[model samples]
Target: MAGVESAFPTKRLSVPTADPQPSFLVFGAPRIEEAEIAEVEACLRSGWLGTGPRVAQFEQDFARWRGVTPSRVAAVNSCTAALHVSMVAANLEPESEVITTPLTFCATVNAILHAGLTPVLADVDPHTQNIDPAAIEAAITPRTRAILPVHFAGRPCDMDRIMAIANKHGLVVVEDCAHAIESEFRGRPVGTFGDFGCFSFYVTKNVVTGEGGMILGRHEESIARARILALHGMSKDAWHRFSDQGYRHYQVVECGFKYNMMDLQAAIGIHQLARVEANWQRRRQLWERYDQDLAGLPLQLPPPPEPDTRHGYHLYTVMIDETRCGIGRDGFLEAMNTARIGTGVHYLSVPEHPYYQQRFGWRPDQWPHAVRLGRQTVSLPLSPAMSHADLARVIEAVHGLIPA
Candidate 1:
């Protein structure tokens, strides 16, 4: 609460700024183009639509993007699966403690639970909306085996500091890069600094794969095991086992899950990854435009990206404190919906959810910064698919909704 500002001085609009657009503007809509459509069509026609050539190609392309070798990357079904499989592949001991940010999506914590490890939460920095390095340091314990830091809103966490802390304590670093495909810190890519970096390609993600994820690991052996663990722990995946050359026999060496990415999903991801930079630039433009247009309003726009770091430009989130803006966060969301515009709350602090609160016996007050930020934060429409006119409508709606 000390770091979060609940009020800001600004004026209210006397009348509506503009009428709502005829069609609803979807939030976080990915820019799916003809290239993706064509690739998907080609995949369907090829008939190898499961875990096959396309998924392998996507892994190679993603590895190149992250500056990692193909052997160090594995494509999975979702970031959640990536995180879980990575943890299992890392050989973390049962009941070990994993410290992570409380301000992230529940999947970050659930992955820890699914891995048979206990999750420990550290508060986040309200300004950067990232896991505070100091909080992570304080959260360490004798049983602590790793730290999972989410790059909230696509802003890279303080990896330099986080990795340093991990090194000091001999803890594994697993980066939750769900919002950070194109992000970097101090000239290094995000997933490279950690032992394992998990990425998301959900429909609304910077790179849309309908539903897919990738793991970028530092060690080849660990990543190879991760690949095995992702697809039923078999000695050979389906493609290798039943190729045109021969029908090879296989063995199940370890218990695993059905988390492998399908060729169909990878088909879309391939084109999406190819256009990642172009899409990021478009989102960056939209983000800057929003900052400029909404500066005069009573809202807390995202802080500027740190110097020497490349923000992924994933989600453009703003804090809408009721005391300052005369409208609660939910009220603003409803108002946007009524205006035929979609919006989102990036998250409610992990403790705010009933399941987590009950399971962990946690309370919102334990992480005051996360609770405060989560309650007031709203994700605006920052998709690369949006046109200039769409952006204008969002800004006008925000300006028009200010209570007098």
Candidate 2:
């Protein structure tokens, strides 16, 4: 459970010598402003509220922004739905296995279960909190049908290694990109790497629409299948049906569910997407300040991307090894809370969930790396809403709590 060291520790951080203090704090607030609200109101007034022009435009815009064709993107109501649709498109057989990280949100694994795939817990590399790519080959077996890799906390996984293993094993790749909106890996955006990339626009995400998601597929057919799975399995073009040239005939070609994105949400999303770039810049500056300010602090700062990638700053997390910090993560959080500062845990290892434990019978020691992460990690507030004073207060609190 060793943590990675940062390069500029001398100038970036200092070990705390006193108790900390923070008057206020925030985490991942929506970057949208009044214009976003106006967009939604326009949609409301338009009266075509359900999966209509606005939703279609959102899907089209999202695809264009991602540099993918429109047919390769399917807008849905939740990342969970996007994942569910992706898993179905994967055509996984019942009881087939999918290897995924334990240090992700439950939705990632639950999507596998909902698709009737057996979820296999893979321990993370403590350094990255990403599924250890090396362990994946060992986890693969005849029953393995897919590998779902989550870009944890907006940090892209080593896609090259993961993809290589998937190709060798003939397993499908479904990336859980719920935390990563514009995250990149090796100079390419994250959602573009895998067979299917599922994104969440939950209130807390980098590009959110209150509640919605998008699935980016690698192939037109695969993307089309996802659309079918999302919209009650209607195979015909849902759009052309109502036009004069459109035919009345349609077919329920597949067994599917309704996971369509509503016009209202899409309206909100159009504006959120525009502000993401600017919000990301401020996020980078704030993140750098946190690292620099806490450089010599007792615990290690989270490592930056390895020169070839960009983190979306979804969560400004730092790892605390009690042995180094002289306090465990829980105690440190308590101290921060007492100082009127707020904090959050991104997740514990996914396998620790009751359903997984009962079904997989996995143990904490089995994924030692993920277990260690759950024990030692804490999420510092990082959002565009935070002011300079708020940032300073967080630094002050952390510096105060570290034992000299």
Q: List clash counts for every candidate, in order.
A: 0, 13
Residue pairs in candidate 1 whose N, alpha carbon or C atoms collide under 3 angstroms: none
Question: Under the 3 Å rule for N, CA and C atoms, how many clashes does model 2 have?
Answer: 13
Per residue, candidate 2 scores C-alpha lDDT tens digits across 1-404 of: 33545433657566777755434455555667898889888888877677878888898889888998999999999999999999999778898999998898888888888898888877888888888998888888889989999998889999999999988888899999998988999989998888999999998888889999999999898988899889889875445465456576779999899898898899999888878888889888999999888887777678887778988778888888888888888998888887777788878777667877887787878988888788788999887877898889889888887853
lDDT of 1 at 194: 91
Q: What is model 1's C-alpha RMSD?
A: 11.7
Which 10 consecutive residues of model 2 have the lowest summed lDDT? 1-10
lDDT of each: 0.93, 0.86
Q: What tens digits encode model 1's per-residue C-alpha lDDT throughout 281-368?
A: 9999999999999999889999999999999988889899898999999999999999989998988999999998888899899999
Q: Model 1 reaches what TM-score against the true structure? A: 0.94
Give candidates' CA RMSD values in order.
11.7, 12.3
Model 1 residue 213 lDDT score:
95
